[model samples]
Target chain A: MALKGWKELEPGVVILEPGNTIEYKSGTWRTFRPVIDMEKCIHCMICWIYCPDSCIMVKDSKLVGFDYEHCKGCGICAHECPKEAITMIEEAKAKAEEAK
Target chain B: MVEAMVKKPIVKALEGDKAVTEAIRQINPDVMAAYPVTPQTEIVMEFAELVAEGLVDTEYIRVESEHAAMSSCIGAASAGARAMTATCGPGLALMWETLWVTSGLRCPIVMAVVNRSLSAPLNILTDQTDMMGSRDSGWVQIYAENHQEVYDNFIQAVRIAEHPDVMLPIMCGHAGFVLGHTLGRVEVLPDEVVRKFVGEYKPLYSILDIEHPKTIGAYDHWDYFFEHRRQLFEAINNVLRVIPEIAQEYGKISGRYYGLVESYRLDDAEVAILIIGSGAGACREAVDAMRQKGVKAGMLKVRCFRPFPADEIVKALKGKKAVAAMDRCECFGGEGGPLFIEACSAFFNRGLPMKMIDYFYGLGGRDTVPSEFCDIFRELFQIAETDKIKPPLVRYLAVRE
Candidate 1:
């Protein structure tokens, strides 16, 4: 019984359903973003499997790109890249570079 | 569900823990997760026997830790089960976090607490320390004065906890060893009567319900935290109204009456001693002794501790010349004890003019006999007669210190 406000929800209302974290937009908490160099990429999909937020996108056994929408930018993907294909850049700098 | 019904009660000589086990057997809850702890082990032990005998269909999970015990109950309770557990002392301390989780979620789980002293010097004796420590965890707390009351409290707890207006979990406590090990005459009601009385488990919200899935224990942030907490207060506030109604129903079945507070010989008394749990037994004798000595002394036993019967207390001790609030647990470095602080504050808030003092007694299973209570009542009588409370208003009774 959810009482008035979040009292019934209790303090720090735990997310109930699975995959609801996608709606949380954790990327907003990010100060840095992982940028991948496709030419240097080995397509080993290690980053795809190791991203804590599951932000690394893969289609048909191939690494496509980072889904920055939900990435908190902890740099696990950059840290996990065996081929040195990924680089961590300031989110604002990446945005400016993209804008350029 | 209605087929397995027995129509008459069987009176039996049983200890406090056995009485709790009998009540659990009658109620036949959906889930019970417990870990063994001293003074509380017999309760889980007997219940486990029932489970082994296949006498009840309860899912008895013998968990590894008290934390897991309460955690499993929380999981089952969230899944719309009538979940329960039992423990005492450090076990209760271990389950502290999950106690908040269960009560904060408004799960109607019932716990049978065999009250024992907390450990520092490693004592395993009867006292109110353990349960008193968890007073703020948002659960309804009831103290039984005897073995029969222990059984009655546990039976009634299911109703109180499940009452829609008051879905807070309940902890029904009795003194460890003192009551937990002592045998007493307990008249248990017919299985059908108890089953019908406790009724079926109704789920307001269930994690297991697929069609109407809902979130429980959701991560509540500061934005709405106050309102959520206020909801708990709203439910507990409803308990004052709900408890009596449930007790009245219980009375209809058992031919007994109960209330939040039991006022004994207080009507015409000039001085009274207020206490909780089994200590009232001695306080009553002290009251009798005071009466023989022409001192108008009485006793008020607070059966329900949480959603504390503040109004009942204020009304019971209002016109008295003096009162002594006795606490079984100590609140070190604080003003008096927990019960004393509450009683003092309650009287002060209600504008009741009475010379009041508090005493710490029966700590770590140390005995507080009728003589100690007589001493307390005598002091209260002195204060009432002279309108002067002794300088050290808060003192330890019978302590070497």
Candidate 2:
């Protein structure tokens, strides 16, 4: 029955799972994948500098695009963009957060 | 923090990184130093959006490094503003030496740490090792399990840290990869509720006047410096009483109460568990399996580990014969788990024959299935029954098979 390392936190407190009410799933809408329109965009990297998640990328010294991996769909870039270039679409619309 | 707001806006599915932005929008925080990290980028981004939209009446300081992020906050807070900043693993690690000085100077600054795993090895998972390592920096730390707790902790930390009796800085961290990414139904309490919860800030030392002359953080030799440390310890001791009072007062309005350690199903159990961060979920699933098998068990979630909570902990585990300490980070050669060893020290002086087991699991997002957890508890119970105690050390799941 004993596996090895796992134990109760105290005599009764637990550091691992104890029951079936599993509520630990990351459902959709937690992600905000941003699409960058290169044409309308001025290379204003305000979003890049201000992003708390660092989900955007500036490649080869040019503002290439956004990184969906860590983007929580906060949409601050779209809101802060001067050119209206970055738009926040749901994660289901394009490549997922993990793929990047 | 909510100053004369008609009502609170609806709860939005926000990230842990975004809590600062929301708090700024609601509180209209006077000054903020914005820095970006992998997971915490959302925080600065949202605040920038608020600044751009003109939604919140606040000034945002766009800083370059994590050091500047905290530096700006320290400067702003001292100049009589509700100042804030955020960082993850490495970024937070960079804010190190400055943090100690900020608190020692008695700045009641509030900050949100998007908890991420530290690395020379480079892993971006959720772990408390970063924040845990900073526990000695004189900042009061509160750990939130979900997005709602994330929001609530920020509101409470500002008031608690700024309280006159406890003019220590506060650091409340959220599990970056989980709550940071987990969008869920978070009920936004009405402005009335929040206002009632986070009362007016009565700053004891925060004063700004061009005409007046004052001195702070002056050069002190060993004679004066030694007294400062003693005085600092006395201030911290006041927090043990102050924190509980604030939590109880906040509970009346919000209908939610948080204590130093949260206990569930531990009253009549023979075995107990301990953990912080989001790893408590794994233990919950495993405990159900043990219960079905007729193993009486419970859990004591250690949300407040710093003030040590010795009395509450002793009350929680006084009768239990075996306790399991789960840790996400190793203690190197010192003990089985880092948090485990810290909690074990509480009991060491008691001279009671309690069997404390330490397990290092779920580090770097290693898959912690419920079955694996159940096996750990079974192993701990076995050790207890046989009256055999292994060396107080860290045990890895890889060693089990």
Candidate 3:
């Protein structure tokens, strides 16, 4: 009545749970670079609300945001921001060029 | 996982995705089911075209959706035929339910999920979100950094997934735009050589036959669900046990080494950063740069993500002061990312490192340079050696308080 092992599952059907041998790079090297426009910026928490990695820093309903640590640069916040206040940029090479 | 399978070295140049197609072609799967999306769509299209040309004699199932692509392949594979499908993002998400069923059934079908972005705006771009989201499915997942590895992994994936102890559907991946669309020169071995690499499907059961009648997708009750699941667990735990045998066999056929974890600068590392997917290349370049500058940073690129390789991870980072779990997917209130959460939970039974910080980057095909990786390692080393500093919820470039 009950299937016990590989035999009972199906006639000669191999019983396996699942195992992944391949590994992905930890978040694809996120350096959150948020772009905000002060002119069109209307204070809204939509970006904050939908931050997948929650890298936004908000105070007094005004955007004084930083990439902090977990910023994956997913650009979700930038994409969702009602004010067009954020544009995601990569910090790896861009920042280097800026320092140069 | 590279091997010299072809005896005749009449090599032809091909792309990574093309190489995957060729590898699957050589494997000679019975049913090839696929849907179109970026990165991976090219590979599937190439294969579909291969079918049309009669270059490979196989039933090509052009499914309407990715979910169906995986499902139809599962049916074909369940009936004791080697089967495959390719998808990414929404396609991968569509196949989520079937992914569970295939693994639970222990069907050794092969699928490739070119990592791509999920959507609200319905962007048809690249990201690891889909595969990371389906991380729970009982499927073996592998991430390929470039074309060479993608070719090698595709060939190796079938063998590993089909192994008696590791009977699960497989999804080998690469960065969609980076590896998928990149048209670099790849060697296309003769069909004979590839044939040698992938011999035949040694299915546990025969395809729909009059003699061997049994049920698939059957009902299992509360009396023994966990027990059924435990058998799958044993298969995962024991995969490493038989992997070496397969790797050794592969080495005999092909010279490339498919290793436990590709370690770079890990010997004297105070901080070990673990990278998965194609981004490992960036991490490797970053490690080299760090080494040149006298920084004691090392890297462990995870070649396999499923089977949860806990022992391998713990052993790799055991004595290291800290480990950074870089993930492409965000984990909301949980750890910084999915890889971080999975790796953190993994250390429960081992002497895992104390400090772990997840760095997110390159969603939707953004380029991640070596310098950013170096800065991440620099920040990671400082965090590991001293009092731990909490990671900010959102870290953006130029958004410093």
Order the numbered candidates by TM-score, best leading.
1, 3, 2
lDDT of each: 0.87, 0.72, 0.73
Q: What are the per-model DockQ values?
A: 0.34, 0.01, 0.04
The DockQ-derived docking category for candidate 3 is incorrect
TM-score of 2: 0.75
Please report the candidate that would top TM-score against the real structure.
1
lDDT of 3 by residue, B293-383 (tens): 8988899988788767677777787777877777776455664777776677778656444567767777766777788888888777777
Ranking by lDDT: 1, 3, 2
Stretches > 4 Å off in candidate 3: A1-100, B1-13, B185-189, B385-387, B393-401
List clashing residue pairs in candidate 1.
Answer: A6-B228, A7-B228, A12-B219, A12-B220, A13-B218, A13-B219, A13-B220, A14-B217, A14-B218, A14-B219
Where does the lowest 10-residue lDDT sum fall in candidate 1 chain A? A6-15
By TM-score, the better pick of 1 and 2 is 1
Categorize the docking of model 1: acceptable
Candidate 1, DockQ to 2 decimals? 0.34
Q: What is the lDDT of residue B285 in candidate 2?
A: 77
Q: How close is every model to the real structure, measured as TM-score?
A: 0.91, 0.75, 0.76
Candidate 2 A-chain TM-score: 0.61
